[model samples]
Target: MVKKTDVLVIGAGPAGIISALTAKRYYPDKNILVMKDVKNGCIPCGIPYMFWSLKNPDDNKLGMDSLKKNNIDVILGKAVTVDRENKIVAASDGEEYKYEKLILAFGSNPIKPPIAGIDKAGIYPILKDMDYLKTVIGELKDAKNVLVLGGGFIGVEFADEFSKISGLNVYLAEILPRLLGNSFDEEFSVLAEEKLKEQGVQVLTNNKVTEFLGEKKVQGVRFDSGEEIKIDGAILGIGAVPNTDIASNAKLGIGKGKGIWVDEYMRTSDPDIFAVGDCAEKKDFYTRRRASVMLASTATAEARIAGANLYRLKVVRENKGTIAIYSTYVDGLVLGSAGLTEQSAKKEGFEIISSASETIDKHPGSLPGSNKIQVKLIFSKHSGILMGGQVVGGISAGEVINIIGMAIQQRVSMSELETLQMATHPYLTSAPTMYPIVIAAQNAAAKV
Candidate 1:
């Protein structure tokens, strides 16, 4: 049977859901159909918390209530091929879809490195599917010593959560010198490492795993230095790659980042089709060079842009580039970063000035729940424009880094930030007289 729809969206992750919802909001008269392979999907960001924070794994499920409430239709099937010449999509369910406009939000797949014995049992690669995660949870219940490969946010978070499972021995292995090395500066990475270590996580930095060791299953791992550790289970949190098999088979242009090539409006080579989320190519905000950043936040933003521009150029705001903003929490410590880091800026050949300020989040530093907040701002030395910033402190750091992101997007200058006006209350925010953001800007302005 062949189903017909004015707008067809593939994948039901954040990108797919948001794109469908936004399209409905813009073109209420258009019929939208979203085809998702998984009947029940889990929130991408909330997946890590399912290990411990969430009482039930179902708590992290991404329900279809939103699409249902909006009167959008959804189907359960995997799209096997796309006939762009006729605007038809064939799915594994033995059905065809005739789409007036198609949006691809197929998302990404976890990267499993090529190491001997890696395919052995007991090695779980993080996936967004709910049924697969349930299986992982069940298998992990019997694991005594757990090893997590890669020290990015996912690996670090998994290590932290696994450490709380009563008597589980969790080990985190990072080939880099520190955890989160690509996202944060050395100091911030060190802070995260310290917090993880405090939670009884055995962090092994500068360690390269040569191969997975086992007879029939993954029983241990041998490092390059010939050191081996026995582990009952292991998780591959290395990274993810764009899922572009369908797109490639359809003869779509792939970008340098190994994702579907799309223009500023998120339209692929075929004007009638669009791509968003991790499946689409991304460029650096400042450099305009190909970049690999797959975040739920970035995906949704692209979805909105693609949805609004599907039929016509309804939204003037085109995606300039990806800023790579990120935020993560460890124990009680929260870390947030936006744009480029100090190390990254230097490597990009930009003459920069960086400054940091430490202050309490609330007034007087004696407030009952006041916590210390540190802010770091990086600026183009010659231009004095905000380029990047990082924050560490209470939960408020999450929003604080967002404020800095806006500054970077707008190219706010150091002098302007130094005198920028903001709302403040005795209990809710830092004192106006010593705001860390303003202070950090002032310190940088002095050198600028």
Candidate 2:
């Protein structure tokens, strides 16, 4: 049987759902349908919380009620092929859907490194599917020792969550010298390591897992230094690769990063199709080089662009490359990084000045729940324009980095930031006289 839709979005992830809903809002008269292989999808970021804070995987499920309320159709099936010549998508079961405009948000797959015994039964890779994660959670229920490979956000979060369970020994191993090496500076990364260590997690840095030891199931891991650690199970969070098989099969243009090549308006080489999310190629905001950032936030932003411009360019917005904004919480501390770090700017050969300030989040330093907030701002020495920022503090740090992101996007300079105005309350924020961001900008300006 053949089905027809005005806009067909393949994949029900953040990108796919946002794109379909955005299309529905822009083109109210059109029929929009989103299809994915999984019937129940868990919130991607909330997956780690399921092990402890959330109790079960089902507790972190992503609901389709919003799609239903917007009159968007949802289908549960895996798309096997895309016939771009006829603008049709075929499912494995021989079902077909014809579309006027197609959006590919096929997402990504976890990367499994070529290590010996990697295919053991007790080894699991982080997946977005609900059922698969539930099974993994079940398997980990009786596990006393768990090893998590990779020190990225996913791996750190998994290690933290798994460590929360009583009697479970969680070990996090990373090849990099510090945790969160790609996003934050050494200071921030070291702080994360310190915090994780305080939480009873064995944090190993600059170590390579050469082999997974086991007979039929993973029992432990051997490091390059000839050290072995016994583990009941292992979770691989090394990274992910874009799922562009269908796009490649359809002869769509692929980027250097192995993602579907897309223009600023989220259009593929073929005008009738568009791509977004983890499966779509991204470019760096500063260098304009192809980047491999696959965050759900970035995906939703791209989806909005593609959805609005499906029929015509109604929205005047376009993606200006990726800024790579990231934030995470380990224990009670919140860490956020936006744009480039000091190390990244220096590596990129930019003459940069960095300034850091430490202050209490609440005024007077005597308020209850007050925490020390640290802000680091990086600026171009020549232009004095804000290039990046990092924050480590209480819950407010998450939103503070967003302000710095806007500064980078709008090309705000240190001078402008020094005199920036913000509303402050004694209970909510630091004193107006000693705001961390403003002070940090002032320090940078003095250096300039």
Candidate 3:
């Protein structure tokens, strides 16, 4: 059977949903349909919290009410083939979809490293599918020792969540020198390591998993140091790769990072088709080189850009580049980073100056719930342009880093930030005189 739509979205993840909704908002008269494989989807970012923090796992479900209310059509099936010539997609649902415009938001697949015994039964690769996650949770209900590989944000978060289990021995191992090394500098990485250790999570840094050990199921992992430890279950958080099978089958260009290549407007090689989310290639905001950054925030931004410019480029939204903004929480501590880190900037050969400021989140350090917030700003020494920023503190740090992200996007300079004005409250934010961002910028500006 042949079904036709004005705009057909090939996935229902964050990017797909946003693109569909945005298209509907801009072109209200267009018929929009979203196709997805999974009937139930979990909030990708909230998946780790489902293991401990969330009282009910279902609370993390990606609600479809918004789609229903907006009158966007949805179909469940896997896209198998894309006939670009015919402008149709063949799906496992046994239907042929014809679209005036096609948006490919196929998302990504978790990376399962090529280690011996990796196919063991007790190993779980973090997937966005809720049903699979529920099964993994059920299997781990009585687990005593759990090992999580990779010390990235997801791995660290999973280790912290598993540590919350009354009697679980959670272990987080990273090949890098410190946790979050790729995104944060040593000081911030060490801070996260310390917090995880304080939560009773055994953090093993500079450890490489040589192999997964067991006959039928993973019973232990062998590290590069010739050390092995028994584990009841294991989780793989190495990362993910773009799912571009359909696009590749259609002969669409792939980027250096293995994602579908898209222009600034999120349009693929075939102008009639568009791609977004994890499946789309991203360029570094500074270097303009291919970057592997897969965040729902970044995906939605691309979605908005693609959706708005699909037919006529109505909104003038263009994806300049990905800034690689990230935020994660461990216990009561929240860490947020945007753009490049000081270490990364130095490694990238950018003459950079960085400054740090520490202050109480609320005025009067004696406040009952006050927390010390540390902000670090990195700037190009020659241009004085903000390159990146990191914040470590209470919940405020999450939103604080976003401000830094905006500053980086707008090319805000140290001088501009020094005189930046912001609303401050005794109970809500740090004292105006000691605002961390402004202070850090001022300190850097003085050196400049």
> Considering lDDT, which of the candidate structures 1 and 3 is the better prediction for this target?
3
Return the lDDT, model 1, position 150: 94
Checking candidate 1 for backbone clashes, the offending pairs are none
Candidate lDDT scores, in order, read 0.93, 0.92, 0.93
TM per candidate comes to 0.99, 0.99, 0.99
Worst 10 residues of 3 by lDDT: 311-320
So what's the TM-score on candidate 3? 0.99
Quick one: RMSD of model 2? 0.9
Look at candidate 1 and tell me the lDDT of residue 400.
Answer: 92
Report the lDDT tens digits of candidate 2 across residue range 279-320: 999999999988878899999999999999998975477888
lDDT of 3 by residue, 1-448 (tens): 6888989999899999999999998899999999999988999999999998997899999987788799999888888998989889999867999989999999999999998889999999988989998999999888899999999999999999998999999999999889998898888888999999999999999999998988897889999999999998999999999999999999999999999999999999999899999999999999999998999999999999999998987545998899999999999899999999999899889999999999999987777789999999999999999999999999889999999999999999999999999999988899999999999999998887
Give per-residue CA lDDT, model 1, range 301-391, as digits (tens): 9999999999998657489899999899888788999999999999999999999999999997898888899999999999999999999
lDDT for 24 (candidate 1): 96
Question: What is candidate 2's CA lDDT for residue 94?
Answer: 88
